[model samples]
Target chain A: MSEAIKDLLKKNHMSVTDSRLQILDMFYHAPGALAHADIEKKASDKIDRVTIYRTLQTFEEKGIIHTIPTADNSVKYALCKDQCAEGHHHDNHVHFVCDKCSKTICLDDVHVPEVKLPKGFQPHQSNMVVNGFCSDCRS
Target chain B: MSEAIKDLLKKNHMSVTDSRLQILDMFYHAPGALAHADIEKKASDKIDRVTIYRTLQTFEEKGIIHTIPTADNSVKYALCKDQCAEGHHHDNHVHFVCDKCSKTICLDDVHVPEVKLPKGFQPHQSNMVVNGFCSDCRS
Candidate 1:
């Protein structure tokens, strides 16, 4: 785990710091997307709120992770695929929020479909969030 | 404008209040959606942050307005159509975020297309936000 985290940081041109390692490790093990409150609750006492916030921001800026917007005003974060890089993100996939478990699972295989926009509206990117019961919850 | 606000509030079964009137008035005149910060900046000094927050919550619950999630974690609110009712929202249209003007416009005519999900994932509601340059921006 530590080696993988170190390699990811190196690839993103970020320094291998304790805070980054710890946060990255959390993302690696998270079954679904994580909210800021979730990280604050699960993070070690040594790491403060501001540090966690900044680390998440840096990770996002580096394209190490992508954000999933929720209706309840809490933005969730999940690890990005290898296609993502600094200042660029290719995570054009659907995000599933389980209504029963409240787990946000990235359906990487399901790509967001294109919408027919009105004339003069040029689309750069699109995001789709589906609320549903996950397979795990159903089982 | 005042009459429309009052009629909308009465239809939603919410009593007309000064703060509610002011906030709803903002939504009515907004070119696109309005965020909490935008409300705070435009609201009168008599209205406090807490009042604004509570008013938004009530309005959402009463189905007077619907939330549009943004990638920046700031949830924007817009007025709902007549189809919406208490605890039920029929605002299934796509939301467009203008990259240049930073406005979140509700494309009322463009409906969200259904995506084929994996088995066991029962979809309840879906939200699609497309980021691009609005017609005004392009023009």
Candidate 2:
């Protein structure tokens, strides 16, 4: 898993620093996308707060992760699939946030459908967030 | 237009005050969702900053407006149609954010496609945001 993280960072031309490695490790084991607080809690004193924030920003810009917006205005992030690169993100799929557990997950099986805009409205890409109860929460 | 604002506020069971009225008027005339900064700039010397923020939160809870989340982590809000009332919002349609002008407009005509999640996932509501160039920017 650590090797995979290093390779991904190298592929994206990012330096394989300790902070990036630790953050990647957290995402690797997470059941779904994680909020800033979640990441901080899991980091558990190994990393500082500001560094984690900067690392998240860098990862997002590099397409290593994608932001998931929640109803409460807090943001979460999930790993990007291989299809996502520096300048292109083909990870435009539906995201599901569990109301009970507050887990934000990427529903990879479901793709965002193309919407036909009215005249003069040109679209580049889209995002869809579905709020509901996940399997674990329901059970 | 101001009278319309007062009536809408009253219909939603909110106290029709000056702050609420001015904010509603801003949304009424907005070409698309206005960020907090956009609203502040347009509010001129009429509304204070904290009041505007509180008013936005109230309006969102009352279903007078819906938030549109952008990639930059800045949120924007647009007026809801009559279909949206206090405690209910039928504005589950695609939103278009112009890359050039940063205008976030509701594509009320394009409804969000229902995605049948894998077994155990139950969906309640969804929001779709599309990013691209707007008509004005394209021209």
Leading candidate by TM-score: 2
Task: Give the interface RMSD of candidate 1.
Answer: 1.1
Deviating ranges (above 4 Å) for candidate 2: none
Q: Pick the candidate with the highest lDDT.
A: 1
User: What digit string (tens of lDDT, one per residue) describes model 1 on residues A9-104?
Assistant: 898788899889988899999999998888888887578889888999999999889898776667799998764868788899999999889999
The first chain of model 1 has a TM-score of 0.93
Weakest lDDT window of 10 consecutive positions for candidate 1 chain B = B81-90
Q: A27, model 1: CA deviation in Å?
A: 1.7
Per-residue C-alpha lDDT of model 2 across residues B1-139, encoded as one tens digit per residue: 5887788888878897877877788888888888888888887566888998899988888888888766556788888775366677778778888999888888878888887888999888887788899999986
Clashing pairs in 2: none
Candidate 1: share of reference interface contacts reproduced: 0.84
Tens-digit per-residue lDDT, A16-49, candidate 2: 9988999999998999998888888888557888
lDDT of 2 at A125: 83
lDDT of 1 by residue, B1-139 (tens): 5997899889878899998999999998999999899999998757898988999999989888988977666878999965477888888999999999999999999999999998889898999999989998885
DockQ of each: 0.77, 0.73
